[model samples]
Target chain A: MPRSSTYEAVLDASLFTPAQLQPTAVGRLAFQAGTRWMRDHVCSHRTLVHEHRVGFVLWSWQLEYVHPLRFPDADDAVVEVTARIRGPRASQLEVEMTLEGPAGVAVRTRAASVPLRLSGDEALSGVPRPLPDALVAAFHDDEIERTAHRSQVRALRAGFERDGEQLAAAVSEFRVHRHHCEVADQWYWAETLGFAAGAREELVLKYGKAVPGLRRAQAEPIRRVDVTWLRAGQLWDLLQVRTTAHRLGEGLAFVHELGLADDEDGGPYAVVVERI
Target chain B: MIVKVRGVLLRFTDYENEIEVGGNTVRAGLAALTERYPNLGKVLLDRTGEVRPTHLIALNGERLTRSELDREATDDDRVDIVTAVSGG
Candidate 1:
């Protein structure tokens, strides 16, 4: 039967900044909620990665700040997180998470992952495999027809690549440290969020004085974000983030692409689009 | 020329981040460096002794194509051996 996993915890002051709930904190919560959902509703992570020799590599994820966020009134307030398995395509599994506080659903996130076989002395393969029968049975057909955010994100990225005018662009570089990696020494997926945020801040610092419209990003909260991952960066890998500012009608948008600093012609490891 | 070994490649280079070698061409420089560290060669090159597609060799700050490996280099040139470690 199809089911949703619920995780609840007391809100902590550390989870917020001076203004509102931290985006990275929300990402961490969503990730943990998804993991718990998998363990309880589907299967244990150990069974999937160790026994099955498979890894759920994220392809794309989207987050929408649905409600205006503010600091909680009570110090002991609680947060409720619900994770639902949305759709399992030919080789992809999707999960949607909602975080509700006193105000109602404050943040909504959806992630799409593809199972990749992981074993042997050879480098990890990028080829995706179909979900196991047992795994497929864990989800239902009700949400199978739901629209996928990855398609829309891809089309937006393609549009930006083709004819979108760039108001300003900046390139910055960093190395993947051990702290940035997961069990396999591959940079954790959430780190992509940080890279994109850093790139956008750098853009504002460098160009906000000239383009006053860019300063609006600093004043406004990020209303929506869409991310697509193409590859993973390993520990010690030198990576670069290219941030481009664009005019989205009357609003402002930022597109960040992370790739190997060495490969100028290769595609990015990830692309992040943020609307402010 | 100077060859800079980074990340996991440093292990193959005996943890030496930079190695000085003598060669006229980019390929020759890499060959000389790998000859000094056979273990590094095994990981960086393929059966045909060509730089593996997974690894990239950059001259100074510019990436060099496979065909451009024969391009000449001087002692002042800096070579970087790079590969993407993060994978999905």
Candidate 2:
């Protein structure tokens, strides 16, 4: 049988909004659940990375909301999270995860990650490497669904290219500070979600009256989020988040491109699409 | 001049979204603001009393570079103090 793992955590106010869990919080917790699953099912991540000189980098991630996930106002509202490995390939793998409340699953996440060769200094080498056979063997045979990763970002970009009309757009400029960094002084990947939200809010604040269409995003919940990271941003690096609003079905979608504020030729470090 | 406080920094400003302070430059206005809200002073400035680089400034809807903090401003100018989103 394929292995699955469960994690239990007490909810805090910081993790919740009035209607649901904060998207960033969901991303953080979902990643944690997937990591715990990997540690339980395979060798420990520390040993795999430190001893085997292998590291996993997120290539793409998608989250879909099933319900308005909420927790009661209490000191100890515990939520259950479960994750299962899926689509394990030679150099890439995917994890299917769910966050469950009392009623049922509220959010589903599928993230694709690629293994990298850590350099001698423990720096991310950006070089793809094959997964250790023993580690891949730890996964259930049926869970080894070898398939190419489909990027939601590419599809959305293609759609936007065809449409070619932006309802609204704005750019938010800021510097990556120590607070945004990891041990290597590189901005943590999950912080992109927060930057996207801030950029969206700034857009609404600046042009909500001029372009009322963007208000739909301000009032509604994000139904889905797709993210792709192209590179890492280091501390004190000035960056810009370029956000554009678009019509999606009966709702709205926002595309955020984060890149160097001054380096136009460098292109975006990350692209995030949020569907409301 | 009025300095608009945003996001988590609002808690440090007595929940005041907009605050009026006296100054002719961005630095002077910030100085007055910090004097009024001592708690915010600690968070908004570094040991050198310069604005933290993590926070961005917009004067009258135009982005301002760190060197432009000393640029002249009028009493009618609106300064927006936005905390750059970062991981904790």
CAPRI docking class of candidate 2: incorrect
- C-alpha lDDT of residue B41 in model 2: 81
TM-score of chain A of 2: 0.90
- On lDDT, the leading prediction is 2
Which tens-of-lDDT digit does each residue in A13-105 have in candidate 2? 888767777888888887777778777877676776677766676768898988666657343323344333344356667777887776667
lDDT of each residue in A1-276, candidate 1, tens digit only: 346776565677877755556677777777777787778766778777666656677878888888755666434333344333334344666777887766777788888876665532133322356666666666566534344335357777667657666789999998888787676557788888888888898989999999888988888888888888887777687899999988856767889989989887878889889887
Q: How far is A168's C-alpha from truth in model 1 (Å)? A: 1.9
Model 2 chain A: lowest-lDDT 10 consecutive positions: A118-127
Candidate 2 reaches a DockQ of 0.02
